[model samples]
Target: MTTLPVRPVTDVPARPQPAAPRREHRLRSLDGLRLVAALMVAVYHYAGRGGEVARAWGTSPAEQFPTLHSYAAYGCLGVQVFFVISGFVICMSGWGRSLTSFFASRASRLLPAYWAAVVLVTAVFALPVVAYEAVSPSDALLNLTMLQMPLGVDRVLGVCWTLWAEVRFYALFALCVVLPGVNRRRVILFCAGWTLAAALTRSVHEPLLDLVLMPEYAPFFIGGVGLHLLHRDRRDGYGWGIVAVSFLIGQHYAVRDLWNAADPHAFAHRTSGGIVLVVAFAFVAVGAIALGLLNGVNWRWLTTAGALTYPFYLVHEHLGWPAIQLLHRTWGLPSYATLPLTVAAMLILARLVHGWVEKPLTPRLRGVLNKAR
Candidate 1:
């Protein structure tokens, strides 16, 4: 028998492993980009086709502001930029949080200002304000839930449709990825799965599925998720692949819907090449930020600008249209003057909402949600 030497164990305990440093979540440049996107939409709504939506200029907007309209015509594509940023921001924020936490965060962020805007717009419309279609009381109540669109109620504000889109994205992301716990693999799967579902559902006449998948806007959001992966892991080939594929699919849809033949809006008649270029630039911009190209962008003002974007976007159109109508039709301001002034006023109001509503309400709402959970 081989002699077995008895080994003596030491009394020392094992050392604790060091925790990883948390990545800083804030991207100041992206805040600036958010402001840019909000401003783009504002410009498009106010000046695109010469304020045709409001018809406040008393003449054809396309003809009244031909120079400005030429460029602002593509500003509607800012919505695509917004969806892409939402993807990146949502994934970045949702990572490592519980599903309840995610829900609370989104609700807190979206609802306070949304509620205020709904009330404000409804009240303004109820009065003899600018002659836009008045939202009914029942519709206003549904709008408060942000479920007006799916419930077959008219939107209190046309821009509310985008909020519904965002809510759907959040729902899908929460259930599929966040509920199970967010990880690189899960996010990749979510992106791929959503893309496929969106594609398949495009031809299927299922209203519910179409609403959930949002086929027209899915690529931008998916690409944002992929880009966030790259941001987190540092230069991932798989992430780049996802972004590339998303761009291709998204580009095709953008051209088809906005330019080629699918209910082509009169203002969306830009050269297909131009639309492709703008969409390409949007992807490249977000991708660059993800890859840390914008890391050194530490401008503090971008923070304030970013905070104002949501309320600015929320209140801009419905409120500003009336302002535009009054200033142009009643006060005799020129289109150029009226547009800028209206935007300035909206921005000021956004700052106020950010300060009075969002800043105060978000934390309280979040606290309530946390306790309920």
Candidate 2:
């Protein structure tokens, strides 16, 4: 073989690899938003139960303060905010992962705590001292499967109705993520189309499908996912401003319904206005991403408080009515005093439950599930 001319061995430096893009830090503003939302829900429940403060506050001319009853009446809107955040974060976390692993992880994260809560509530309702109405075995089983929404059965734990909706949303989202050759644009379009169809068909008289699909709320979750994609590549301050304005507008409509001296139909129209407001809010959320406003804040205290919100949401409604009734019977306190006191107690208990129960159990359950898998 003819020897090829000897090539010189060049000392070439290896090219440096690009660093992985770091996840945007957790935004404290979102936690703050959560804290406010959870508090609003607690306050709303407390008000509905005829707590002294709620009554007094409602009667007071100060109720129109734009921040007072506005926040209180729209507390349920917090659940919508939660759906949006959940869709965003879950998609972010589970993206690029195997569908099996994702489902397993989600099940571990949610099922154990949820099951425990249901069992405890069932026990409470069944106890001789409580003498609350007992849920049927079928209903309990449905709740266990997170299928109460579609089954047309009353929820075993009333607060858990939303949880079932969340389960459905999660399942649908996972399927979209896992299926082969799925286009992201198509997934978004499908969610949007489904939501629109649900909205259009909502006037149908059948009660069963309405309860199961929860068409009224589907758009909120779908909008949230859309917002996530919009914000993924941009972080401009103007986005935050847009979110602020949308929130304000939504609050305006909510307050108008709560305090307006209009016909009930008028109130319904105003309340329905929030759907559009929330869509606007999504645009703002996208802007927030563009502005880099999503950077994580170091508010350990607020974060800690935020962590307790879920359990607080569950217990507040149950405890609030009884607490108000007891105070009314024993001390004859005014609505204002009893309301604030009851809310304070509920918040305190929520913190305790979060620290003592949910926090401790979440990690252990996750571990067990991981091992099982």
In order, the Cα lDDT scores of the candidates are 0.86, 0.58
Query: Largest lDDT belongs to which candidate?
Result: 1
Q: What is the lDDT of residue 211 in candidate 2?
A: 57
Give per-residue CA lDDT, model 1, range 62-83, as digits (tens).
7668787778878888999999
Candidate 2 similarity to native, TM-score: 0.70
TM-scores for all predictions: 0.92, 0.70
Q: Give candidate 1's error at residue 140 in angstroms.
A: 0.9
Where does candidate 1 have its weakest 10-residue lDDT segment?
Answer: 260-269
